[model samples]
Target: MSSQFLVTSRRDMEERGWDQLDFVYINGDAYVDHPSFAAAVIGRVLESRGYRVGIISQPDWHSAEPFKALGRPRLAALITAGNLDSMLNEKTAAKKFRSRDNYSPGGETGRRPERATIVYANRMREAYKDVPIIIGGIEASLRRFAHYDYWSNKVRHSILLDSKADILSYGMGERSVAEIADALAEGKTTAEMYDIRGICYVTSRAPLSDKAVMCPSYEEVRDDKKAFAEAFKIQYEEQDPYHGRTIIQPSENRFVVQTPPALPLTTEEMDAIYELPFQRRWHPMYDEAGGVPALQEVQFSLTSQRGCFGHCHFCAITSHQGRIIQHRSHESLLREAKRMTELPDFKGYIHDVGGPTANFRHEACGKQRISGACRNRHCIGSEVCPNLDTSHEDYRRLLREIRQVPGVKKVFVRSGLRYDYVLADHNKKFVEELCQYHVSGQLKVAPEHVVKHVTDLMGKADAQAFLKFKEWFDEANRKLGKKQYLVPYFMSSHPGCTLRDAVELAEFLRDMHMQPEQVQDFIPTPGSLSTAMYYTGMNPLTGEKVYVARRPEEKQMQRALMQYKNPANYDIVYKALCQAGRRDLIGFGPKCLIPPRRLKGTRPEQTPQRRGSLQLPKKTRRRDTRGRK
Candidate 1:
């Protein structure tokens, strides 16, 4: 079992009695030999195929010597910015530096250098000038094309180009990485593996592929927001593995060509990947600094599936994992549960038993595998597709089996659940089981917005679906004799959201009596449909104008409306209500969101005069989606 972990140092290599490694994996995360970490998965995959892989976890960026800790590999150096993009790890939407990094050991901050992938690649190049560098993971995957970087506030070139790497494996890289390793082992140069699907590489000359879709050049996207949006739309439509086209993005000196996404692993292949002998814990080297905080969430949690078809515009899962739901078999999950029971830290509780969406245990529909997901229509948004298979019998049965495991006491599903899909199910047994066994009091659901127009732009199901699910949840708890609650999540200042829209959302929240502890201020991360809307002020899908709240004050007002009950947000909420002509909501009425009185210890005369344009509120009563007045 000790030898199962890949070599990380000269001592480990000597222990393994190996002369040299085939690949040296450089990651900006602490070494946690678990599948949840990309370094572990890719390393284990390469090892399973008879390749010797070494790991360099969060090497010091100030010097090149840290990159050469394991010496040079026999073949290539594979790098990932851990499980998250490094810039996002270091900074927030307001561009403020964060104080802690969960992926780092001891939850410390600033362990990895900024722009981690590029930084790591450059450092490795400094160490070994001629070694091939292959970069991937969330950072490289999302930035494979010219992208709008929130931190830099400008379009940046592909990571492959910026990092000067030999190749960039965009999506799930198991198949492509294996093929690259094999090709390299067979005396092929990294540049010759450009034809491999799921990888992007830079070339000095234009690509000669006949089936390529040429995107707006980097200069064009940099100069024109509309051109950027158009290029994003093209990339978005071609993400399907079955029907995706080869995409080529041009630059002045070279071309960045991305092959179509790799085909999804079959159920058997997914089972094999999970069945790999992952120690399922952080490497012992991290034990002294209180271990890796990131593994705590996933240690007891079993990932029964991969990928999501929910297709939320703001989510990057659709772009990275694809819309197809590739799930593990019941036997594989049960074995994993048994394995968890044997672990010394097992607390008789399975923290979670789900993936991106909890209830999705199979493909969205019958034709998804054959025809690929519908690019034009969402499977479960706006309206549930007629072809949508909303049954949860398999998932329900799997949970039942896990509950019966000898050492397991309770199992919870803490991952995001698509409630609209629950509403579409006619069987209704899964909801009962979920409430009876899975939910830990409050079930978290993402109903991003209540306004139909806002939801339409966000590509989410209508609020009525959420309303129906809430009713079902309430009734289920009542029948089961349980005291459970629903914790609905909301997003503020999304594309197309206005001051009026925020006010409407506030009214809906007031009716529901939900004062969320946290509110997500929309951050435009690259490779998402919503980011395209944020950048262009137009729907990439429709090319129609959308009102985007760009001003910091306007964005603050919208976020304030979500938690209007908080005393800190009173001024912003008051001004927003007044500006949106909803002054009727300002008085001391029970329905009012804020009080008309001034703050404590302040004179009434101190209250500022109301602006003349503040229109009198209308008397019409609008029923919420829950049918509440």
Candidate 2:
């Protein structure tokens, strides 16, 4: 297994009979030689082009001593904060420390430092004073522009400025990373590598291109919230690859310049990248420590595409992967499927077969490839555009082909399906087949919320779209004679979401008889329109005033409403109902969120306790919520 993996120690390099390495990848997670991990993908991509690469995972930040273990790379030091932003990985949306880090071995926590990109880059500089350090992955990509840092409670400059790395590869970095490595290897300095797309660097001179856009500087955005919102608007609209311009902003004494994103990979390129020889599992060193938790679901999965067109405000996919989808050919995917069948550990089940959005197997429309995604409009927001390609025929064909492969027991589409996108398509075969074969017990979708304002602010489809899909799903399952369900993911305390809006969503859940086990509290990560709105209190795209739930208590109340049936949320649910002046919902009626407080002098037993706290429960407790009795 160690022979199959990239060089991690001096012994591995010696075993490979190499005295020098082209690039040494520093990652925040334990070294896992899988394409699902960014560190592995970049390393393999470099290897394919005849470059030697090594791995240095989760080095100690106490000093420069640990970074030198892998020795200095001849080309440069490639660094990433693993697959997720270091802060988001370490803390929950409530700013509380997370109990576990799935990306770490044995589901460990505290393995990586806060702001890992900056910390790792600084240490690399200490280890090799003149090494050309490059930072990428979610942390550097989303923070390419000055963004509102929710954890710090202030606006911070672009990560390129803070990390002090020679170059920052912003988006999916297959192209930019290779170009950077080639330039470095060709005796070119980092200062001469500004023309690469999807890369950002700091400079002192003004932008030379007439097409470049001058956004508000760090001082302006930091001092004025309105300035911050305006700057975000420019950043959001300019994500286009075909027509996008270079973005320049002043930071302190220097400036940060970002070129337009790299174009979506061609089918051949996508196929070649995914078909790389990957171990597809955590390093064997962790075999005794229960391996990496993150690989459990993905080891048997296949990534059939890249990019997303949903463009939800809270999501940064469009910012990082762009809005135009790029997919591998069916033949390429089938090849990967065939390989999985031969693995001894494969359970004959392909856990998933999708990307950012499961059903988006192609670009949004023909125009996107030519002129790029519309400047200020979303592909599917309140209404679907007439030019939008709402066909899932290709995706359906791909799934069917996989299912027909040898030794593949079942092919499940575990990733989320844009329900609105499903409804927009006239053909119902995909959804019907999905319900019949792909789904195990449920099909999960994300409507975000039911309130029109919240959905509008979030740039998501309305509740009508979700309900229609739910109806279609239930009918399809009933006709198929299967007892399946639809799990709709809803978030709370998003920008523009108020107490009344939460109440409306709770009532909608009650009407649907849905007791959602999880409710996502909106996290204002960098590089999202929602975070801009959260920081500025105004929608950057629309210029409308937005109500942000900045208080922790308010956000908790909003989250509790969606799970009002849970005994632990009774107090918060009551507080929210009262705050919204919706006392009508606090009664013995079946539609009520919770039973009215037990009579003032009621007996202790009559007051109810633990999970069965509601005295006048309309639904029987049974053995538990699942009726396991």
The local lDDT score (0 to 100) that residue 588 gets in candidate 1 is 86
- Tens digits of per-residue lDDT for model 2 on 332-401? 9999999989888998999999987888888889998888888977788677888899999999899999
Q: After superposition, how far is residue 507 of candidate 2 from its true place, in Å?
A: 0.5
Question: What tens digits encode model 1's per-residue C-alpha lDDT throughout 504-568?
Answer: 99998777766654567777887888888988889978899989898889988998897777777
Most lDDT-accurate candidate? 2
The C-alpha TM-scores of every prediction are 0.94, 0.94
Window of ten residues with lowest summed lDDT in model 2? 620-629
lDDT of 2 at 350: 98
Measured on C-alpha atoms, candidate 1 has an lDDT of 0.84
Residue 67, model 1: Cα distance from true site in angstroms = 0.3
